[model samples]
Target: MQGFSGRFKDLVRRLGVTLFGIFELLGLPRVPEKKDGEGRGKG
Candidate 1:
């Protein structure tokens, strides 16, 4: 059986990383831009 602490920690870390990638793909408001403000590119 796996140790509880290690398994739990890994799960939390994986979850955090997964959530970050998901939000990045979603392009949420809180994410920072390389420029000073929002992108004004042609859509």
Candidate 2:
């Protein structure tokens, strides 16, 4: 069961990567990830 779940997670991640690549080809900007420590001197 653990192995199956891990494989499923990998599949989803790969799908997301493919979709993001397509979006990039269409000239769409990827959303920036938020910093954990919001404001200490990092933009």
Q: Could you give me the TM-score of model 1 versus the true structure?
A: 0.59
Q: Rate the local accuracy (lDDT) of all candidates.
A: 0.84, 0.86
The sequence of per-residue lDDT tens digits that candidate 2 reaches over residues 1-43 is: 5598899999999999999999989878856767997656754
TM-score of each: 0.59, 0.57
- Residue 7 of model 2 has an lDDT of 95
Q: Relative to the unseen true structure, what is the C-alpha lDDT of residue 11 in candidate 2, on a scale of 0 to 100?
A: 96
- The best candidate by lDDT is 2
**Worst lDDT window (10 residues) for model 2?**
34-43
Off by over 4 Å in 1: 30-43
Number of the top TM-score candidate: 1
lDDT value, candidate 2, whole model: 0.86
